[model samples]
Target chain A: MDKFTVHTGTGAPLRASNVDTDQIIPAEYLKRITRHGFEDGLFSAWRKDENFVLNKPEHQGVSVLVAGPDFGTGSSREHAVWALMDYGFKVVISSRFADIFRGNSGKQGLLTAVVDQSAVEQLWKIIEEAPETPVTVDLAEQIITAAGFTTKFEVDSYVRWRLMEGLDDIGLTLKHVDEIEAFEAKRPSFKPKTV
Target chain B: MGRTLAQKVWDDHVVRRAEGEPDLLYIDLHLTHEVTSPQAFDGLRAAGRSVRRTDLTIATEDHNVPTTDIDKPIADPISRAQIDALRVNTAEFGIENYELGNKEQGIVHIIAPQSGLTQPGMTIVCGDSHTSTHGAFGSIGMGIGTSEVEHVLATQTLPLNPFKTMAITVNGKLPAGVTSKDLILAIIAEIGTGGGQGYILEYRGEAIRALSMEGRMTMCNMSIEAGARAGMIAPDETTYEYVRGREHAPTGADWDAAVAYWKTLPSDADAVFDKEVIIDATKLSPFVTWGTNPGQGAPLSATVPSPDDFTDEVDKVATEKALAYMDLTAGMPIRDIKIDTVFIGSCTNGRIEDLRAAAEVLKGKKIADGMRMMVVPGSVRVRLEAMAEGLDKVFAEAGAEWREAGCSMCLGMNPDKLSPGERSASTSNRNFEGRQGPGGRTHLVSPAVAAATAIRGTLSSPADLVGSN
Candidate 1:
């Protein structure tokens, strides 16, 4: 995981709700065992249309996404997050996010910032009107600032710390191996084993 | 205060806990499939780590497996490579894998319970969203991402925050022909897609108790479509009987002891939940989705709703977009929407019982002319069981193709897929845009409704087939 503190980038306004994982990275691109090179698959279906948001000239190379409510609402494929990051998105601002998608974002260091619908609307307005205006997402301050507008965002504190520090989750959990073994020792005898 | 079933299960799995920090919960089972796990295994190799508990983890090849022509090599090179990666990774890590052509090979969720690996009071995790299908046994089964899959493989545990519990109480007996799929679809329609966010749902009340284990699994399977990470039903004789003599189920004294512990796993009578929703199951009819999302549905008897019907801006916009993508008109009868294909398989409704129900509806009746219907079982086991019951002949004689098991056409990973602009009445979970294939449209339906729709060339329910049969 790469450390994330304050990232400044242009924004793309995806004015659609329930932008599910299937739309983000279709299942066709999931055949690759490796994670990189998914940039082409990001919104592959919608990108074909000349009028879609991401295909606009001004929104090219944008790293901040101001999206509708309930973004990433379906599927647990982390490929959704990878595709966003691979396509140059560092921060996704939405009114709400699916639980599993949000959790996956924390692990992968793609910042999912939760704000009220009003904030989302304002951000969309700012980004759509001036796509090149730089937006800064500050994890330390828990706020997003862009084009003279600022709004506080919500994120799990522990996740915030890990993101800022670039900590590996497996390493953090491995620190308590002894406690895990202790629990396993007390587990009931009837629990089925795979082998 | 008494704790809800979710809280009780969460408490039991805690390995470590502290203020301001998520609890370290022990995982009893980890299910994996080919699609989302290859990268996780690659990460472990890069990090010089090995699987911590192979005894608690199992893998299967489903998402990319070709359902037909079982003996031939996979026609898609990329798909074959992914499956090969899983075969190699599982062998290297010493994890048990049921690969393609294996007798036990199937969708991960379908095989887990059928083998008696899923039990009450356990915590199960998988990389697929439909892991909630296992929660029918009073367990906490959640879907995770590739990173979490790697974490679980390395440690057999997850750090998690507590979840809020919501009681979805469905009272009254479900009317005839109103299956659990209809009941759950109706629930999701009422709640909207995001209604269950940040909550674990517990299905309770008389209506839930009346459902068979397969029905309960169908209900829990789609909890994700409503934004719930997991959904559960308390274990009872229904659950026990389903698990009693499967391959991995406890035997002799172990079985007795397991049942004793399971008896204590249900929520106490006075247990309180963070939220409660009550529904009269008697009012539900055969349900189907008319839009891209599962929540965008209504009873089969209703008409396509106009965007003007929604006051919420997001919902209104979504409805308009859905109507356009689905090529549907407002005020059009749902039953009048025509379909080109009918897919009958997935983790949702691919069990033997599901096959039987559909076969019963198709018996002695042919699907409408030019209608393409495929009956792909969830697993080889399910296919074998259906064959033994002579359901395959029924499906074949009715003009539906009886195919091998795997997640065929559930998603677009395999060769079995819907063509662009094609429409299907599918028994799969999602009805998302391009879910079956690019530019493909899917309407989620139960197996029975799928069969009936195949015969009618439209979104019809089993009741419409009564006189025809």
Candidate 2:
């Protein structure tokens, strides 16, 4: 995963709500071991339509995506976040996001910002009107701004810090190795164990 | 304040908590399957980390395993490699893996609780969303991302933000022919798919208490379809009896101790939930999906919904899209919708009880001409159990193919998928477009409904077959 800080890029407005993971990357693409190069498979089903945002040249290479409320609403696949990142989306702004998708985004340094519904509608309007409108998302400031209009967003403080610092979670957890070992030794024998 | 069952479990599992951060909770069990574990195992190797508690982790081959063959090699190369990868990973990690032919091997959710691995007051995590199924044991079972899976594999702990508790109390007895699947679908249709987001829904009330353990598991299994973090039922004598004699269950002295602790897992009498929703179960009929998502459903007798019925613009758009994709008309009666295939198994409905219910409906009756019916068991053990009870003969006589155990047609991971535009009555959790196969249409139903649909070549409940049965 790459470090994420402040990103300013054109926005592609997704006008749908409850945009599920199955739609983001269908189950057929879930096979294969390698995790990279999923850009082509991102929205693979919808991409066939000529009018999809990504297919339109004006919205090409946009790193920010704005969508309606309740985005990333189904399945626990982190592949959904991978598809978005692989498609060059650094930030996804929605009024609400499924918990798993938001968590997956945070782990990959992709920002899932929860803004007010009015802010989402406003962003959709601005980005739809001007296809090449640049949107700036600053993680440190917790703000998303597009074409002179700005809206504040909320994220967990720890997530913001992790993204800003580009910290590796496994490394951070490993620092407490001794404590984990102590707890494991004291764990109940009656509890189910793997072997 | 009295604590909800979920809150009580969370309080018991807390290993560490700090300001401005989520609580680090101890996980008693971690289940893994082929689709999601490859990357996590790779991460551990890349980071030079070891699985923290191999004894607390288990693996199985289910997602991509075929349901038609038992002793042969996997036909799909990708699925073969994934299963092989799990074999290697589990061997290296010292984790107990129930491979394709193992007696205990099956869908991770099905095997865990049945084998007494999932117990009351425990916190469990899996890379698959259907992990919610184990919550019926009065435990916290949540679906984590692959990255989180790696985190838990390495530490035996997950940092989880607390969730609010939603009490879904179902009152009254279910009308004859109504199943747990119908109740869950009705709840999802009443409250949109995202209704339970950020909440651990605790199912309570008279109706819930009256259900068999299998029925409770079926209800909790589909909690994820409603976007709930977890779904739990209070541990009672029903739970204790289910766990008492399983292979991994505690011995006499330990069993008494375990029961004592389990008795405390239920919510207190005065427990106050963050939110509460009461459902009148007696009013529910056999339910089925009419559109793409799980929420776009109605009673088996109701007509397909018009986009005009939606109050939200986004829902309206989704409804229109669903109608177009489903090839359904606004006024078409749901019961009259024709289906090409009837699927009788999945993580949601592939247990012995489900098989019996389905077989009861199909007994001494032939399937409608030109219709295909498949019965895939949840696991090898379930298959053997069903066969021992002569359910296989019942299905075979009715023209339904009784398949080997695995997740077959629940999703299109295996070869048991419908052709494009082919409609099916599936006893699976999801009905998303192409979920059963690319361009396949799915109508979510119970085993009874699937069996009845097979006999009639249309969506139906056992009541619809009163003349035959």
Candidate 3:
């Protein structure tokens, strides 16, 4: 995972709400075993339209996604996060996000910033009005800033710390290997085992 | 304070707890399928870590396998590669895998519970969201991403934060012709998609307890649809009866011990929940989704709601978009809406009981001309059970295609898919746009409703077929 202290990038506004994981990277794109090269599959269904927001020339390569509420609302596919990061989105701003999607985002180092619906509306307006406007997300400060716009976003503090530190969670968990084994040893005999 | 069922299960699994750090919770069972496991396996290998507890892990080939042509090689190289990847990964890792053509092979959620590997008071995690299906057994079942999957594979535990509890108490009995699918759809509609966010929902009260284990699983399976962390029901005689003699279920003395522990897994009467919602299930009828999201639903007796009916600007905009995408007209009666297909299979409603419900509705009858219906069981075991009950003959005789098990036409990762602009009354979880296929419009319904819709060539419930004969 990459450290995400402060990221400055242009934003693209996805006006639609409840933009689910299926819409982010459809099930068809999940067939690939390799993690990279999902840039083509990001929003594959919506990108077909010439008028879709991301398809607009000015929004191309934008790294910040200012989307509607209830973004990433379905499926537990980390491929959604992979697709977003693959397509150059470093941060996603929404009024709300599904639990699994938010967890997946944190693990992959893609910052999911939850702002107020009022703030979301403002960000959407700013990005839609001027696609080139740069938005800055500061994980250390937990704030997002743009031209004449600024707002503090909420994130799990532990996740925020891990993100800024670029800590590998598996490595962190392994430090407690003895505790895990100790707990396992006490598990009941009747517990089902695949073997 | 009396601990709720979720807190009890969660506390029982806590391997380590600290002040600032999240609880390191031991995982009792880890279920994996093809699409999500590949990346996790790669990550484990990249980290030079070995699976800590292969005995607690299981894999299945479901997402990408075709329901047809089981005897032939998979035609799609990409799909085949993914399945092959699972086979290789599980073999190298020494995890138990039920591959395609194996009688034990099926949708991960379905096979787990049917095999009795999903038991009360366990912490179950899967790479798939519908892993909440196991929560029906009074367990703490949750869906995790690939990163977490790898973490569990290497450590048999997860670092997790505490979750708030919501008691969704459904009082009274579900009226006749209203199934658990309808009850859950109604619950989601009442709560909205994001209403249960950050909370573990426990279905309580008389109506929930009355449901069979399969019915409980059906309700729990859609917890993700409501944006909940998981959904659970307190284990009772119904739960024990379902698990009693399964292949993996404990025998004799072990069973006695298990049942005694399970008896202690429900919430105490004095328990105080973070939130509470009381619903009267007696009023619920056959429910269906008219729009894209699972929450955008209504009773089958209602008409399509106009966007203007929504007071919130966000909901209004979303409703308009859903109306446009679904190609549905406002004020049209839901039952009057025609369907191009009727699909009855998925982790949601592919169980043998679900098959029997649809079969009962289709017996000695035929689907309408120009209408297409497919009955794919949840697992090969479910298929065999349905066949033994002569449900296959009933579906075949009704002109509906009886197919093999897998998650066919649910996520459309398989060959069974809806064509562009096609509409379906599907007994699946999501009604999200393009969920079945690109430009495919799905109206989520119960199995009985799906069968009746196929016969009438419209969105009709089983009760609508009454007196017609």
Q: What share of the true interface contacts does each candidate keep?
A: 0.85, 0.51, 0.80
Go through the candidates in order and give each one's C-alpha lDDT: 0.94, 0.88, 0.93
> Predicted chain A of model 1: TM-score relative to the true chain A?
0.98
Clashing pairs in 2: A193-B55, A194-B55
Task: Show where candidate 3 strays beyond 4 Å.
Answer: none
- lDDT for position B288 in model 3: 97
> Residue-wise lDDT of candidate 3 within A1-195, one digit each (tens)?
888899999999889899999999999999999988999999999999999999899998799998888899889999999999999999999999999999999999999999998998899888888888999999989999999799999999999999999999999999999998789889989999988
| Candidate 1 CAPRI classification by DockQ | high
By summed lDDT, the worst window of 10 consecutive residues in model 3 chain A runs over A124-133
Interface RMSD of each: 0.7, 1.4, 0.7
Taking the tens digit of each residue's C-alpha lDDT, what string does model 2 give over B334-424? 8889999999888899999999999998999999999999999998889999999999999999999989889889988788888989999
lDDT of 3 by residue, B1-469 (tens): 7999999999999999988788999999999999998999999998789999999999999889999989899999999999999999999999989999999999999999999999899999999999999999999999999999999999999999989999999999999999999999999999989988999999999999999999999999999899997999999999999999998999989999999999998999899999999999888999999999999999999999999998999999999999999999999999899999999999999998999999999999999999999999999999999989999999999999999889989996889999999999999999998999988999999999999999999999988998885
Q: Which candidate, 2 or 3, would have the higher lDDT against the true structure? A: 3
The collision pairs in model 1 are none
Off by over 4 Å in 2: none
| Model 1, TM vs. native | 0.99
Model 3 score (lDDT)? 0.93
Superior candidate under TM-score, 1 versus 2: 1
What DockQ results do all the predictions give, each relative to the true complex? 0.89, 0.66, 0.86
TM-score of chain B of each: 0.99, 0.99, 0.99
In Å, candidate 1's interface RMSD is: 0.7
